[model samples]
Target: MTHISTTNPATEETIATYDVMTSDVAFDKIEKCHEAFLEWRTKSHADRAPYLRKIAAALRDNADAFATLMTEETGKLLRDGQTEVKLCAQIFEYTAEHGPEILADEDRKHSGGEKRGMITYAPIGVIYSIQPWNFPVYQPVRVLASNLMAGNGVILKHASICTGSGLMLRDVCMKAGLPEGLFDVVIVDHDTSDAMIENKLVRGVTMTGSDGGGRHIGQVATKNLKKSVLELGSNDAYLVLEDADIELAVKTCVQGRLYNNSETCVSAKRFVVTEAVYDAFTSAFVEQMKAIRLGDPTAEDTQLGPLSSAEQFDTISEQVSKSVEGGAEVLCGGSAPDRTGYYYPATVLANCQPGTPAYDDEIFGPVAAIIKAKDDADAMRIANDSRYGLGGGIFSKDEDKALQLARDHFDTGMVRINSFGAADPNMPFGGVKDSGFGREHGGFGMKEFVNTKAIYLP
Candidate 1:
């Protein structure tokens, strides 16, 4: 079985080759992970932190190489890719720094003098991780670092295009001095993955991908009576009230969408603007979008890279076409670049209707769907109508009012008022509804990989 094959999204050309894991090897790796789980669970969080720190050191030591490889594999800018590695380090370091305290027994006494109780954390065994190509490095590390720190073994089934990222992460773990099988990377296509999910050795599952991917995994995990943590795609709204700063909102919108070539799950998909400043916001947004530099992801000056894969380019292109037909006025950049990889120029749309495909559908490209509303109520209504509720942003001069509106109205799991949000090592990031379930970062992240045990000590 072939484990890997080299391909570039930029030139749409074969770069190299790799091996794939057959079912037999996949099962063996699962078995090893299950066996390794027993030993890994014996260590304390204190013991785990040193290993995590070593992983952090290794990530910093090999930042450039890892970033270059990541850029080659996933078509993110080298700086972005390097930044991902640094975040991966922070995932480990944060878990190492805080996991122990969170997992430590909490001494709580009932005010009614009922009893005293202590809560403890335990390894939940081998977790099946299915990650996407967009965040080839940080996604897996977010789940894996917390899992390892909490004393659980991890079995990664990474994106075929980003198989190298998973392998490289394992190498980093080994370099950090983890025991064999504690963090195993298995290569398997989709169907074979289903088989592994049913395996008794695999006790839990977590995924970071599209809504469809999350739902499919959710079904599998539910049928098998296992746990799952998902970080799915979001048609997250960026609400720009009439009182909003045109410059700040425009700048943040461009930053959010163009970052990752708009391959991010939580990229601001819709722009909900009140009619008062709608034209100014739209003009400023288009101007900024035009200013974004699209070049080889490896280049330092590149602000945007090609879509990570040929398939994604087609889907995004089709989405843009269909959205335009559904009544969105294409303001700029609705076509692919004449380049090697799957390159689409940044696009901006105006006159987007509430029920239009462009309005609710997640824009996974450099396209921003603009939905104009007569008033704040209409803006809120449009923003809250999406089935997806992952992450959202609000821009307004009345920060307090905007926050309250977001808190009360938006259905997303997290909100960034006047700022573009990403996975912060210290914050819990997740989603609701079609965007998937469970959390991937911070305290919630560490808990995802562990089994909680209660001790009643009176």
Candidate 2:
């Protein structure tokens, strides 16, 4: 394909088209980005702080326009898109405020306290980031802010569906005084992307996608001995323990499953309920899932929007069908609505056995899998059965018990006790197992692509 086109998932209409760039052009841009990094690397961490502040300001200034574009391009709800912009701005602000202290040189005594050792975090070269479409603005911004603060150039290979959002982000940064070529958005296909990964100029690669995709990228980067961070998929399980608050569990599980049109990687996908409260929890959970108001993303009252594309809609539909055929029973919605856009109804599945997609795979849609457990111990066992361990939740009126389960028993990277929420800039993010490795946010991402040099003073 010579060009890439952006489509409105809600309207199924073409929003815009972008001409694809050749490998030669992408290489030239990479070279220029490296040159820019050469200059940026000379700046101290304190000197790099104001640029992030300026970028944060630019994001806020264009929040409305950028949010609308994201909604049109990816079927993100208008309110959600606006919130995403704000979160991206907040990430920049957090990095700006904390980066200097986080990356400052540390003096240590070595050789029996006779020699002084100085450790410095220095920027590497260009970092290539391949991001997904779920949180268009926030995904790229999280990477860009920390790396820029670390004085590294960045190249974004955003999902084709949200190309407009990618360009809009770059434009906002450039307008905020980011140097030209310091951050570039490449318009290319996956083949070109893979080749670009092997380029000598790019010092590191970070990607957010499925485990399969993560494996491919990690292999390519590792083959060339380049560092990579993979934030992959998750089939997060929210356990409704025997002592759980039925009402709170129902409400939070519903909110977690349905947020972001139920496409979030770490959002609640499996609901493991203890038999003592299984019936009560499923009854209210299914009712709420069925009550979700799916409509145009721009509307104020719409609780859910369409899937990001027809392909996504079909994939979710197939997963549901296969799960049902494999013995899962639909408690509420089980099919797509008879509508013009790529819309799938919020669905609830019970009698989910281990052989079915609802139980075994990560269904990236608004379909909740309700699994019955013998007790609280069995519920934790079921939750830990999954191969992916990204994020999860444990609900119980006994805060101490819930905290213990989250801390000692839960196998996920992040476990929310008696609550449900997404990314917070102050907290560490990323997961283990098939969900991928490495940490982001909370000052960890700034060091992912940096050179930690040890200076020995004689």
Candidate 3:
């Protein structure tokens, strides 16, 4: 009898309500997904690739409708929604084209070349995915694209706020010739979700959310002896070196911060600038943040949109307030406006030091925390001081030096030099430390839930 209500954060209106599935119903769906996996696993990778291509074409064909639905449900900009659809389509295409090559069986010589051996990547059963509202389509597609190509069925328990998008994606896949039950979305309460995770049919669990959620899911998967991949939240830092292009750094950082209305996990939340360029970068960054147009998400000129929900707005507001109380200076925006919906203006916090939320926590909104470093070394040190290391960036005129630093010094899972990006289908994505474990994309995801069976021919 329980249900989830989808709301438009930009308009503060309920879009639709979906009934939550009972434990029995959820289990039935899981059973069906497992059955689909059994049948899907029997197909060759070549056979699977065409369906993925069809899915990609369907995504493009329906991009407008899907993007509008996402924007309506999550308050993301219309353009952003469209971009997400395109990105997801690209992910499906990439997985279809490259998955088989990545999952091909490997031949090796055993015991000093005396015997022949082979290692095959075999599909497991159902993979349970728990995704977030931000980048609703991309988050789920990122997991689904790889798993589908790997011949594994997927079951999604998406964020309550974006349940509609989740179900829509499932429908889209099915409409694109994906077999029934190959991808399923379950609307359920927390208890039901936990029960699903505990279900023996689910061989692996992949989640993209906060660290707290990741910990709970990871523990459950561990206790049940199921594999898991967690992509948790982070307060990623973007370092501006003394020799950096201040203008370019400011521009890129602004785009990164406000990309998803500044609700992205990998968005540059913290700005660590060397003393030499700190003033310039901070001034320009604050000015840009101050001038951002925050209004209707459908407006083409609007640069920032509302937070995904009132709860999300409250969280960001409290984080900013606590940071200010902890000795951080508000450069532009520090409080919510009196406007309707869950709108929070683009905010910039400076004079940030350790022991402050601005310095330590992830501000999941249109807020930027600026930190001053004595030099490049100090900037690097400051960037590595965070407990979360999901992703980070460094900007320097010397591309070689920046590349080396990112390769050898940056402690995060993914890093960008002289630019910023959320993800690339061909590159490995994930993080270390409290940011959670396991990589996605870049052929890594296609094998995460696959069994590597070893065979010896003596």
Candidate 4:
């Protein structure tokens, strides 16, 4: 009789409640997914492409409805919700078009001249995905689209706050001609989720969440001897170098920090500015942050929305308070408003130093920490002084120098020069260090849960 209730963060109203499945019911879903995988793996890549295309069409056809539902469930901007659905559609289209070529067997010449070798990519069994609520549709679709194209079945245990989005996606896939049991959404508690990870049929575990959650899942998967991919939390730094464009840097950095209510893992949480332009960038950034319009997510004029939940709001508020107590300065916003819903303003913290939450922790809300560096070298050094290395950015007028810095100096898995973006379908995404491992976009994701078999011909 366990249940999870969904709420509208903007209105503070309950939307609906869903019953959590018992252990037996959850296992039955897993069994059905495994059975589908057996048949799906036997199909050729060509046969799977059309179904993926159908999924893309279904997403696009129902984008408006799905986007509204996501906004209602997660407090994301309505326009952003629509954009998320479109991005997911693009992922499906990309996987369908390129999956066959990427998964094709590679012809290789053996070290011995007399022998020839070929490497073939083969689909593994069910992949268990545990996703977060920030980018509800895109997050799950990022894993599901690539896995389905690789001929593997997927079972999702999405964040309880967005359970309706997960189930709706499953319904959309089925309506698009996807075979039943191929993709399943399970509603279960934490204990059942851990047991599902240990299930023999789940060959791989992929999760996108906090660093703490990643550690727990990674340990459980390791104990069970299953391959796991974790995309954990990050406090990514966006460096404003001495030779940067001040105007462009200020605008882009603000957008980077406040996008998606600033809940994005790859969003620019820390601003590392060189001494040469630190004053100018900081002034402009604070002014812009203070002017942001925070209101109803459904309103087109509203640039920011409430946090996904009250817990998220409390976490951000506590981090800001601790950072201020540890010697950080509030440039614009530092406290939550006395409002009915879980709303926090776009905040900018200045004079940020090490050992403070503002500088060290990932503030998963609309808060930006600004730090001053002596020069470009110092800025780069400051950016790398973090345990989390998921994503970072560089802003410089010299494209050549920025590209060189990104390639040679940046220590993260993904970096941008003079720009900020969450993800791209054609690029490899993921991170190193405490941010977790495994790449998810481009052609890399299609093979993460696949097996590589080598055959030699002499």
Candidate 5:
């Protein structure tokens, strides 16, 4: 049997190994999940709340262990891992608290009020979730909690690097009163995963990864006539306007970029600075980015952690090299320290023109690309220049102008005004254009895989 081994990216220490399942085994598991869904779909939304609540409690109870495992597996900062655990718990709690209402049957008028109709959101079937390693706990939970509450069984195909986290999540759900086979994590290869997506038992699919991967899976699911929700990658831009407070912009941009070691899909990757404050913002941002020392993720004093894997380290390093070759200037960090683990320092690049990775592609690490804009209008233009529209930010002392820009002109699904955050349960999270379609969180996800059936009464 082929086995997958997980390692601590910070220390390059092997953590655990697990055997991969055959396509047949995975298919059989899907059959079992469909059976569970058959029974689960009979329950009212209220009946599902208790299960989610218990899972949330279990997550909190085991927060430290889960955080430790995440740190060991992906080199996530301990504090960030702990926060991820909390966020996962909150997601479960949020689903439990609000799912019933979100999925509640609604009365409506049809035929110009001549007929009364009731629209019901019904569970489809098994939902196949393809999640990434970056935010392992939260990524799976975003789909799992909502789907379970909506009365669908969920199967998670997490990234190979964080296999343990996926299995551990399944264990927690089972122990927290989730019915057996209702939520399962499959240890299978990509080919098996595609086969599972084409399985009749799986009614829908959700994926979080690169646009390239999203397109492949989305096509497969579409070919199978299955519904799909894809939350893909992004090269999100954060703009510092002429009237912005350089201190806040610098600090928030750094936090946004370095969060999760900058592996996040929605994190700030591009900085568009208006000429008025270009000098101030770039100077402070580069200085602060330089001061962030890469060290042991488990250490409290360490401000920056290693990339998630040796592959990730190499990818970031190469991207930086190519960006510099393509006329981008490394303002702060451009080289990885000779270390035991997959360590890459916080880096900032300027003079980032088009046709470079720093200018157009998503560099999934602690590297920041700075683009100079002629003015505020040019900054917005630069921010919207990318093919990606997952999330972006605008920092201006004018709250009204920032809100207006985010609401009207900012061409992303989500925008943060003068602040930085990964996600909030109360807000919808997803992206547009190359970032992919569909929204998750704030009740949007609960309906993504459900069937909207309209019942009419004459």
Candidate 6:
């Protein structure tokens, strides 16, 4: 038997352990997937729709179990966990309803009547997905929906911490009448990840992780000539102008950071508050950060929870200390909660030097650092100075100014004015520069898994 163990960050206990396949077993699984995909890819889009629908049904039926397991393993709020599960179903359903059309036959004419051309979408072979643990089920669900509908088999190298969640996903897909080998979950360490990439079984790979990890994996994928998409790290900045609505800005910004116990790569890290409104914004932001409840993740009333692991806590804490050393202010919370769990208080550091450790770096835990900007130019400079260009925000009463800030900036991918970092399935989601390479969860997602073949007939 091959499986991995689960750790409860809340209790410092090993809740369960499952087997992880050996190299031989993994290679065999690859063989099975390759065999299955040949027939699976030939199936009509109409045929694929039913399996997608069944997956949605299975997820809805087992939502409770999935949510509980998610909370137990990652220490996120129960509702947040449920949201992830629900989104999983929604993604599958959306694909079922709209995917076939996206892959429909393309009509074209070329060289007058002498020759005619058409564009047809066909499935790529195997897609290797290296996923993160933050969204657990939701993250994989997005990948699964797009790849499966595109008639591609997927080999998921999910995060070790979310091993249990990954198994549940595989089980649900199988129960939905999907072929056994269409999707296989592999629980291998980093070394095996490199091996899988080099195995010649993985045709394309998409990864979401730290910037450094993405670069390494991407290099390997490129070397192997495998198409790759990566959603790496982000240090989003929320620029609040003096004319902005203080109340709405503060509320939305907090949600962006604390949405996943601050584990999200897209969470806002730098609060570039203009000097004129810095005082008021800080006061209200601290008030909101204080009211957040850090109860057990299984509790529905809990708004905030612990980081997924001790290492996450340590990293965030170290960043805060570095910020203070470089002359920063602790607006509200800085240290971890005084108890047993991996709970860190909602830390706020002010007077953080732009481009310093705290302001520019991606903190994958529940801590925020604010920097006061002298003017709009300073705010733009601070926002652009980051090595990362994933997502960002600008809050201003003047619509023109807000739009201008977004346009005249180096912030790549997506930018939400007066809102937080959220990805609607209909919207294209990806980062630029050091953040990541390709898009996910939209029409663009399907392209990653399919071969866009153009045909000529005479």
Q: Rate the local accuracy (lDDT) of all candidates.
A: 0.84, 0.93, 0.93, 0.93, 0.93, 0.85
TM-score of each: 0.96, 0.99, 0.99, 0.99, 0.99, 0.96
lDDT of 2 by residue, 1-458 (tens): 99989999988999999999999999998999999999999999989999999999999999999999999988999999899899999999999999999999999889999999999999999999999999999999989999999999999999999999999999999999999999999999888999899999999999999999999999999999999999998999999988898998899999999998898998999999999999899899988888899999999999999999999988899999999998999988887879889998899999899988899889998899999999999999999999899999999999999999888989988999888888999998999999999889999999998999999998
lDDT of 2: 0.93
Residue-level lDDT for 113 in candidate 2: 100
**Over 4 Å off in model 6, which ranges?**
1-4, 112-114, 407-410
Residue range 325-373, candidate 6, lDDT tens digits = 8888888888766898888888788888754678778888777878888
Q: Which ten residues in a row have the lowest lDDT in candidate 4?
A: 106-115
- List runs of model 1 lying over 4 Å from the truth: 1-4, 109-114, 354-356
Give per-residue CA lDDT, model 5, range 150-222, as digits (tens). Answer: 9999999999999999999999989988999999999998889999998999999999999999999999999
- Name every residue pair that clashes in candidate 5: none
Count steric clashes of candidate 5.
0
What does candidate 6 score on TM? 0.96
Q: Where does model 2 exceed 4 Å of error?
A: none
- Which residue pairs in candidate 6 collide? 2-19, 2-20, 3-18, 3-19, 3-20, 4-18, 333-347
**After aligning candidate 1 to the native by TM-score, how far in Å is the CA of 359 from where it should be?**
1.6
Question: Each prediction's Cα RMSD?
Answer: 1.6, 0.8, 0.9, 0.9, 0.9, 1.8
**Between candidates 1 and 2, the lDDT winner:** 2
Question: Which stretches in model 5 have alpha-carbon errors above 4 Å?
Answer: none
lDDT of 1 by residue, 97-210 (tens): 998887776676664758887777878789999988888888888888888877889999888888787898899888779888889898887888998999998889998887
Measured by TM-score, how close is model 4 to the native structure?
0.99
Superposed by TM-score, candidate 2 places the C-alpha of residue 232 at a distance from the truth, in angstroms, of 0.4
The sequence of per-residue lDDT tens digits that candidate 4 reaches over residues 398-427 is 999999999998999999888989999999
- lDDT, candidate 3, 1-458, per-residue tens: 58879999988999999998999999999999998889999999989999999999999888998889989999999999999999999999999999989998899999999999999999998999999999989999999999999999999999999988998899989999999998999998888888898999999999999999999989998999999999998999999999999999999999999998998999999999999988899999998899999999999999998999989998998989998898889999878889889999999998887988899988899889999999999999999998999999999999999999999999999999889899999999999999999999999999999999999998
